[model samples]
Target: MALPWFVKRYPDLNFPVSFPPELLSHIIRDVCYNHDPRHPAFRRACCRMTLVSRAWQAVANSTPSLWRYLLVEYSTSQLHLAAFLRNSGEAPLFLCFRANAPIAADPDMVRQSLLESAVYISHTIRRWVAIDVELKDASVFHSVLLYLASLPSPPLRVLRLACAVPRHADRRSSFAYGFHGPTLRQLALDGAPPWSSPSPPTVALTRLSLHQCSWPNYSDFFEFVSLTSALRHLSIGTVRFAGTLPATVVHLPSLDHVDLLFGSNVDSIPVVASLFSRLTYPALLEVAISFNGYGSVSEFLRTPLAFRASSARLSGICSIDEDFADVYHRLFGVVTLDLSHGQRAMVSALSAEKSHALPLPSLSTLLLYMPNWRSLLDVISSRNDGQLAPLHLRCNYPEHLAVTHHLPHIADHDLESHHRVLSLVSSFSWIHPM
Candidate 1:
């Protein structure tokens, strides 16, 4: 034989005659050394290199792990999509749908394709971390979810769905059965629903988030949460507590954390008072709430449950934000407190006309987001000179939050969290007749 000719073309470089499968990767890497994969040229190089030789082909086919990401625009056709998956190595796929267009799918074909993929995927794909679907309407969700339901997806860990409007009661039932993932964990749904009613309950999920959802009423909303027996972290954008939160709700021996976002808008504080008053989940370690509407944190703080929690967050609470030194003094043991975003405007509106304030003494972690560093220093300092302590500060971009860096008061923590969380309230004095 002619000794495998690629050597003759690059004679100056003196290519190796043969290589172990791993060395083949080094050769491919060198060929595209200066090329950026993010650029079109980089992808083209990959395509061209795959066709180079039989040995290279084996390496290309075996490295399917490189294709762990998936992205699909709204216009992507479902029928063609299955074919794409079949031909593409077993990489996870991500699809973003159109706001107006529904998901196009052939149910039978989708289920069949999933089964076929599983035959090969069980040994090949280690993790299916995320699924992001953005739709124009809820109706589109039905088609995609149905097709997915018929298929097997036990490897999923993160599930996210975003839409302009929320799914109606009828559409929500699609998740009631057929699909199950004991290993499944994070779940987030956005936008408001079209019709409001009690939807299917969810269980086995560790973290749950609902943003701008439409519920039929208070009772219906509670009924929906009755499903999450396994939920550990609960974050809501709107918490409408018009009804009961299940007599069995507090017994969630596994539930220890709670996040209430803008709950005061829908009578949530009163309900929270009622719930904690009636049921006591002693294991509860963290509680995060943005008391933005009405009601004071006094009621919640005075509860019997206070002794059980190690950390808590209350956003927009008048008692906390008004520069009240006493409030900060009461929460001395708090390890991390985030007063960054929600009520900065409220502070500015009232601060311009106030007297000098005292600095906080017990704080170790303080986050500031306002343009006024002077005010921030006053709040964290005991002196007025505006010098800060060694406390960690997370603000604008140069250093965003890494996992270990987040000082998420109480709302974001899971029951499994042991990190010490603490917060300090800003102290306020009268305008002194300015």
Candidate 2:
């Protein structure tokens, strides 16, 4: 087999190798797969492996899995693309096609090159396990979508499509395609095409993420999700909803993780309530919701959506009324609470005296980003009244020593002072720095 151009250029350079071909192949696979395929370092490392030694080159050439991840760009030469595809053999491929605004002298030629590459890969659609396409030009986007739409059914497991055009731009022509893959398990769409067809064979999907997508009505959104009964993770952000709210409540028995984000639009409040009230997921264990609009946090808390999660992250809340205290107390299943963003009102609500019951009685962990040490101290002391388990607190304070002095009331409890880091799980820590 012919070596890649980079490897052939350095044919005489060989490094000493002690490990067997099998072991070396295993090491190379681990290193290459761990890093993201879109990163330049990943491709560079994959090419560099062949130059390590003749034994390494032979092993790399023989291993089909090493070349299965193909990143095709506008500048990717035909030789490189063909070499990777040939060496990948019949292994399921993870394909990523990126077509950004070209800086080349001949912009039309660059786009044509991208279109040709898309057509070239169309023959291998049956072996595609995952495909991620990101395009900035509308014409190029339409061409790529056309190629994908003409392809036969693939064993695709994941599909992510992103369009960088402005929302006001005419995207109807570019996004007028439906995706259908029975084996698809993950789908992520960002300013991309909408699946308007009645049924597009997404029954096996376990994760769905939609960002900056608009629907004609609320029912359209619900109707799409009602199909993914086996979905485990659902994430929606900055999605626009219109028309009357749907009465149908979609039941997702297998869903466990949900992340929602609302932009600064007052109309979203009712839509948010409608969405939460409509969906019922019994297996849900974690939820993170952010509100960037003007509305009462209590309005969403009043929804029938089960807040029966072990951990919950709530942020972007501006204020809370006295009724919020009552609604907040209902989240009895939440053991860990994250109030790291604009949630000082929540701290006050938790600290407030209620003649009936304590807010979040089952809560044992608290993550706060409050600058006020006195209020933080007050809440900690109030919650540790011996009725509930000791609160494990993690927060950021300007003066660590000053906060430590004020913590004499609940000093015996598990207290952690974070300078710039909060110990919340990386996935739940979506709040940007203040």
Candidate 3:
């Protein structure tokens, strides 16, 4: 057999004349695995690897892991899908089915293609370890759901399903019943029903992310949370809620990270406040809350549960009063605080003169987005006393540059000492424009 194309093309260059089949297989797997099967480059690379040499072809064909990831798209040929299924052997599969219609393609053709691929893949459902299905057509989405519902449960670890169709147009039934994967660890749903399953695969789930989903009432949501006792990280974005919440609080002992983002709905204030009041996660390490609505930070801070999170982010808060600051100081052991869309009132509250006790005493890192330097300097100066730890400030590019330029001109020796305590980090790209 001839050497690889690279070695043959560059004959003068020193190349290994022979490689242990195991070593060669590892090399090929690493190269192929780097690109997801959905990417055209992955298929091209796999084809080129087989064409490299007779030995390479044998190794590539024999390694079932190399052919385990199957991307089934509307444009994908049945022959290619069959080849992947055959080559994968008994290895666990990572299947991604994208039923999005190609540009200018007939809708009927797209649906037919998706149906065909779905049928082809259904035979090997038990071998699937992870399944990601993205469908744009409502009919196709429903069809796929029904097909999955009829199939026996797979040992799926990760399940991500996204539907682009509008909610109103889509049927209002629980799609969760279609999926029954007891081993599922991570589940992400976008524009899909959250939980309708009488027995969901929630017990094993560690991470759950819901975007643009609505709960019929708070009880369903709480019940869903109750089932997912092992959940460690929960993220809900722009979720719509209805009905009143129960007075009782739900305890999640294992939860460590909670992220909530409410869109431009003023009604979400009550939902946000209710979550803060209802959920108790003692081991929580990080909490991020953002809402584009007319809600006070004080209302949300009225929860009885005190979070020991070292890091906290509060965005879209236009003002923070001393009361809010006091509550915040009591609620969280926040070592790092991000106030991206903060106002002057918030800065004042952080630097408020408190003779008895300082607010946010544990705060060591402060991240702001394009904050007024004068107000920020005041914060640094006010907290510079021996009582609290020195502040580490991070700001956007323009503000950092401006501060660096003006720092030398400030002639006050005490202020210079304050500046010395600050470790100013200019996270240029990370801090986006408000």
Order of candidate numbers by lDDT, starting with the best = 2, 3, 1
Off by over 4 Å in 1: 1-40, 43-64, 68-130, 134-158, 162-204, 216-232, 253-258, 263-266, 275-285, 291-295, 299-308, 316-365, 371-434
Query: Model 1: what TM-score?
Result: 0.47
**Model 3 lDDT tens row, 280-356:** 76677777776544456656656442354556667766666556645666655554455666656556665555422
Question: Taking the tens digit of each residue's C-alpha lDDT, what string does model 2 give over 359-394?
Answer: 444445666666664676555543333343444556
Top-down TM-score ranking:
2, 3, 1
Q: Which one wins on TM-score?
A: 2
lDDT of 1 by residue, 103-126 (tens): 324434322333223322322333
Error of 2 at 412 (Å): 7.3
Better of 1 and 2 by TM-score: 2
Q: For model 2, give the RMSD to the true fold.
A: 11.8
Off by over 4 Å in 2: 1-30, 33-65, 74-95, 98-126, 135-153, 163-206, 226-230, 306-311, 335-337, 343-364, 382-386, 396-434
Q: What TM-score, computed on C-alpha atoms, does each candidate reach? A: 0.47, 0.59, 0.58
